[model samples]
Target: MTNPKSEPEMAGMETDQTITPVIMSGGAGTRLWPASQGDHPKQLLSLIGERTLIQDTALRLRGRATGFAFTDPLIVCNESQLVPIRTQLADIGQTAWFMTEPCPRNTAPCALMAALEIAGREPDALMLLAPADHYIRDEAAFHQAIGRAVPAARSGHIVTFGITPTAPETGYGYIEAAEPLDAHASRVAAFHEKPDFETARRYLASGNMFWNAGIFLCRPDVLIAEMQALREDIFKACQTTFAASPKTKDTRALDAALFAACPAQSIDYAVMEKTTKAAIVEADIGWSDIGSWRALRDLAAATDGNAVRGNVLALESKDNLIYTDGPLVAALGVDNLAIVVHEGQILVAAMDRVQDVKTIVEALKNKS
Candidate 1:
């Protein structure tokens, strides 16, 4: 493991004009299912290239024109993932702060904890909330978009990055921008949850809706205020958790009972849906959450109508995604199918039906 000891410290970046990268790595990423297990989720796996998704997300903040605004990312993840998070950070020579969670209370509490932490440390700090597992092909455009959002974030509005919909994707929620705030920004008209195929198609045709990218930027105080006003219980939960400065001995393992006691809700539900301070920024940076095997297959480039990963071997497969680790995989006459073998577990499902693969995992768990 390479030590980032010599790297310049960014401890006080909030004062020196830097954006705090708050990464959320708590979820099990169940959509990817068997391939992304509870013990080792998708964020820890090298689902894309040589680097894990978490690694990619942490490094994406570097080399920006925001004047060292992106540094020492504060990673909010589950307790089980601390070692891997540290290993990946050390492996890539990136400095980070770990905000560990003992239990999963969904994203609202997770993000609220981060906000409270930052607010306590630096009330004026602008933090960017991002998911660890996402695919963004156009790095330049992504950086440009980040730069564009800083101004809005600084202006006291909760900014959300909305990816311009290329197709009718039923997997992601949609955000409707009411009017153009500028060339790069707009006012959020409303938030829409994931829709059916026909509704998604209509959204695509409207050209006013963008896929909710789960990326947000805002000042810590603003988020706290908005959250407190929107859902007082969530705000109070985060306050109680932070009031005692949740123990850092075990990588800041949050109080499990307290976290579970907090209501399970997403940030969108707890705050964004009710806040009038919401702003949307649309960009075509080639983004996807890579939530499912089918989504991963769509993101992966196809060669001869097949997308293969890890130790895979295909003979007559077409339009298939084969992802396995260590095990040698062989496919014959398979089309539009996903085959994933990981740690003695195999998942085989039609590409279109990959969304239902979680049922198999649930069944497997029942047997265990």
Candidate 2:
């Protein structure tokens, strides 16, 4: 193993300006089953590139090449993920602080807790809220998007990064960019929920819509204010949990009972949809949330039409996703399906039905 001591420190940022990266890492990742379990989620696994998804996410803002400066990340995740996340980041020589959630309360409360925590300390800090399981291929474009959003964010706009829709993707929500705030940013006209295939097609044809990338850049004050106004109950509950809980070393645990009582909602639903100050920066970066097996398969799509890993042998398979953990995955004349072999589980489902994989996890939970 190479010494992590040689890894670069957080550098290249101007002295006066700094961005605090608050990474939301609390995803169960059930759509990517067998390989992604409750204990070990997809963010910790190297599904695509050499690095784990969370590692890729962490370094997205920090780099000598991009010159994007960031403080050590404040990671919010379940307690079970701490050890693996710690070990993973250490391998890359990146140091981060962990905020452990007492229970899973979704992203709205997670974002609220982080915004409040950071606001308590640095009142004027700029925070870039990013998901831990996205894949962005273009680093330069991603950095440029952040650069464009910073000015808007500092001007008190809650700037959400929007991805230019490559296809009519029904899996993501859409943000209709109404008017240009500038050459790079736009004022959000309306936030559209996930559309059906027909609606998504119309959105793509309109040329005014962008995929809601779930990435945001805002000051702590701005975020907290929006949360308070839009979701007072969540704000109060998270505040109570924060006040009641204590920090030990680099970890802060939320009050489980208090937090569990908080309303479950996404940050988009709670704030961005209702906020008048919502702004958007168009990012052409190759981005995918990789929420399903089909998405992951598309990443490694080969000339032979197979996206495979480990000990996979496809005799005549085409347009199929075949994966193996510790066993052999053999496919013959299969097409448009996902086949996964784990230590004790074998998953085979149609590519179209891959999104329903979460039902399997739900069934297991009900049985227990």
Candidate 3:
């Protein structure tokens, strides 16, 4: 593995300053099961175009020299996924400094490890923390939003990107923000979990809420301080784990022992909910978490109100969404239904009821 320190020219980063991207890529993506499996999660899936989600994230940093500055990312991924990680990065003709988790210790530990690494390079280094599997259709707008948030990060605020909600989505957490920090940013009021349909409708009507985009920008020192105050146990574990692990290509050897010792917790529960420095940026640039097969179908839908992919044969099918990479899918006179044909599994359900696919997965587990 080449030294990350030697890749200064990639981002046009200054010798005196550094900003690392921290990608959190360790979710099973259960909602997108069948296609997204435990062995190969959603981030590794090539859902959009030729590039996998992980590669798209890594390549997001590669473009014409933008004034908004950033360094190469430090990817925090699971031990079992190192091979896919390597292959994905190689496919993009880029390499990221990887810190493999010994176990699935969640985003809190992941972010903390990233902060520890970033702190070593520049004590006040900024970090762009994001998931690898999210979709943003507007890259120019995303870059513009990042430019707006950079000053907020510099001023020691943990800035989170909140998507302007297009619908009453009960699946996403909401961020209530009031008053703009500048022209484009806002001070976060609170974070709320997924609500019921009626409550989601109210949130949508209020116009003060944004879908939690799970994208954060902050300085390493500020995050360290916040984690130290809000989640000391996680902070200490991360410090110890980073100290013991060698910064090399072969990080799989120590992953199990280290992860087993660390506690599992999401960043929201571990730090964001408890931090007073929490702030949010409200923007709508066509963002989606792609949480379910339903969402994937909706995203691929054409203007005529139908989405079809793979070996799909539809007859008299209107307003139906079909996704199949395996098995010949034949749809007849179905509307508002999602059909997923893969492997030996065939999922055919009402689009509105697709969220209950997890229940079926649970029942299948019981049968095993």
Candidate of highest lDDT? 2
Query: What are the RMSDs of all candidates, in order?
Result: 6.2, 6.7, 5.0
Candidates 2 and 3, the one with greater lDDT: 2
Off by over 4 Å in 3: 1-18, 63-66, 249-255
Cα lDDT tens digits, model 1, 64-177, are: 464335657789988888888899889999888878777888889888888877776666567889998887888778877877776667666789999989888898999999
Worst 10-residue stretch by lDDT in candidate 2? 1-10
| Candidate 3 C-alpha RMSD relative to the actual structure | 5.0
Greater-TM-score candidate between 2 and 3: 2
Model 1 residue runs over 4 Å out of place are: 1-16, 66-68, 247-251
lDDT of 2 by residue, 262-358 (tens): 8989998899889988999999999999999999998888998789989988987799998887777788888999999877898999999999999
Residue range 1-368, candidate 3, lDDT tens digits: 11222123333543333457788888778777667776788899888777888888877755433445566677778878888898889877886777777578778888877777777765656788989898888888887777777666767678999898989999999999877777777788889999999999999999899899888988787788888887888777766767777765534233456657877898888888878778888777888888887787778777756788788888887778787887788888888887876667777788888777777777878999
Q: Global lDDT of each model? A: 0.81, 0.85, 0.77
RMSD of 1: 6.2
Report the C-alpha displacement of residue 202, candidate 2, in angstroms.
Answer: 1.4
RMSD of 2: 6.7
Task: Judge candidate 3 against the unseen true structure and give its global Cα lDDT, from 0 to 1.
Answer: 0.77
TM-score of each: 0.92, 0.93, 0.89
